[model samples]
Target chain A: AQSVTQLDSHVSVSEGTPVLLRCNYSSSYSPSLFWYVQHPNKGLQLLLKYTSAATLVKGINGFEAEFKKSETSFHLTKPSAHMSDAAEYFCVVSALNYGGATNKLIFGTGTLLAVQP
Target chain B: EPEVTQTPSHQVTQMGQEVILRCVPISNHLYFYWYRQILGQKVEFLVSFYNNEISEKSEIFDDQFSVERPDGSNFTLKIRSTKLEDSAMYFCASRGQFFQETQYFGPGTRLLVL
Candidate 1:
């Protein structure tokens, strides 16, 4: 069984300050990791994904995350916070062993990002 | 860029009444999926469809749930008998055949069972 854990339920950061959202995963095989953002009453948008090609992955809206195999963590980060960045962030993990199919995504509970102006 | 689209931004129905949620996946996508998120809960997978048939389904998807690709472009999820607990925001997603491809999600339909 594979699962993702987001350490923080809520994170607050001041404008122009750095932001971080922590996530960890447990998988038996190599995993595909993803970060998605959802605004109120809106659909989820993929910020970035890691398919084993690179450890440091950059995403939209000046966001990025590092996949650390040793730590079993994929934490999202941003250099500066913006009001628009306030939203719910989800960390997802997908393994290739999903009965030979790949559309399944195991999601974390979610972390709410609050940007203060 | 192509994306998935779902109809009925919000639907309110009585218990025991049937409801059908509709979605139009990306034109060239081959896989379709349905997921739901209860208030203040993690998103849970319901089912996955391919080649006009169900390829996979989660434990939550039982006899009461069914999926169909009525036309070439439309995919639908039908709940035979709705319950108060069935109220949630349902999301439709689609993915192409690329290895480890990302799934695109629709705006989602909020179903309120009264």
Candidate 2:
């Protein structure tokens, strides 16, 4: 079984400042982790995914996440936040489905990021 | 730059009415999925389809819910009877063989049962 936990429900950052959204996961196997962003009235956009590749994975919109197996954490971060970066971010963990490993995503509750100028 | 497209951005139906949500997955993707997100809640997986068959389904995908690939290009989810609890955003997703685990989502259909 796999589950995702987003530590923050809301985060506010000033424009051009750094942003951080914490996430943790519990999985019995080598899990595939991802970060997705959903803007207002828009569809979910994939940020990045970690599948036993690089520990630090870079994604679109200058965002990135580091998969720390030691701590069972995959936190999303950005060096500079833009006004457009305000959105709802979800942390997802994927595990093999019973019988054949179809892989289903277990999503977090989501964290709302707010950018202030 | 392929995408999964969904129909009826918004739909309003009465209780006990039936509704079908349609999706056209990205061409060449081998796996397709349906997920739902209730208002202000986490997204939950409903079902996954592949090879013209259902691979796996969640507890929420009961007998009242069924999925089908009526044509080569389109996949649909049918709800036999709409309930107030069925109101939510339904998203269609697909993943190519290359990105076997990275599923891309569609714009989603908002179903409102009254």
Candidate 3:
């Protein structure tokens, strides 16, 4: 089974400051990792994903994440935080079933990002 | 770009009543999924549908829940008897058959069971 843990439940950053959200995962096999962001009352939107293609993945809205295999971490980062970036972020892990069925996704509890203007 | 769409942004139902949440996935996507998130809780997977049948499901998808693709365009999640615990925001997602493709999500339906 695959699981994810977000190190922070809430993170506050001032506008124009750098932002960092930590996440870690546990998977027996090779895994696919993703970062998703949800605005207030809105559905989840994919930020980026690491499918073993690249260690550093750049996503929309000037966000990026680096998949570090040795540390089992996939942390999201942004050079500058914007007030509009205030939202909840989730780290997800996906692993193919040993039985050859479809893959299953495990989500982290979520981290709430608050940007102060 | 194509996107997934869901119906009834919010719904309220009495206990034991049956409710159906509807979604229209991206036209060309071949995989569909349903996930739910309780207030202040992590999102949980309910089921995955492909090739007109359920390909995978989580323990949360019990006997009370069923999924149907009544037409080529619409996918539905039916709760046989809704309980108060069933209240949550249900999301529908779809993705193409390609490897490691991102799943596109719908706006979601907030089901409130009274």
Off by over 4 Å in 1: none
Number of residue pairs clashing in candidate 1, backbone atoms closer than 3 angstroms, sequence gap of 3 or more or interchain? 0
Worst 10 residues of 1 chain B by lDDT: B48-57
DockQ, candidate no. 2: 0.72
List model 1 lDDT by residue over A17-84, tens digit each.
99999999998887899999999889999999999999999999999999999999999999999999
Model 2 TM-score is 0.98
Worst 10 residues of 3 chain B by lDDT: B95-104
lDDT of 1 by residue, B8-112 (tens): 999999999999999999999888999999999999988888877888889999999999999889999999999999999999999998758899999999999
Give the poorly placed runs of model 3, Cα more than 4 Å off. Answer: none
Give residue A83's lDDT in candidate 3 (0 to 100).
98
Per-model lDDT? 0.93, 0.93, 0.93
- lDDT string, candidate 2, B38-104, tens digits: 9999999999998889999999999999999988899999999999999999999988765446899
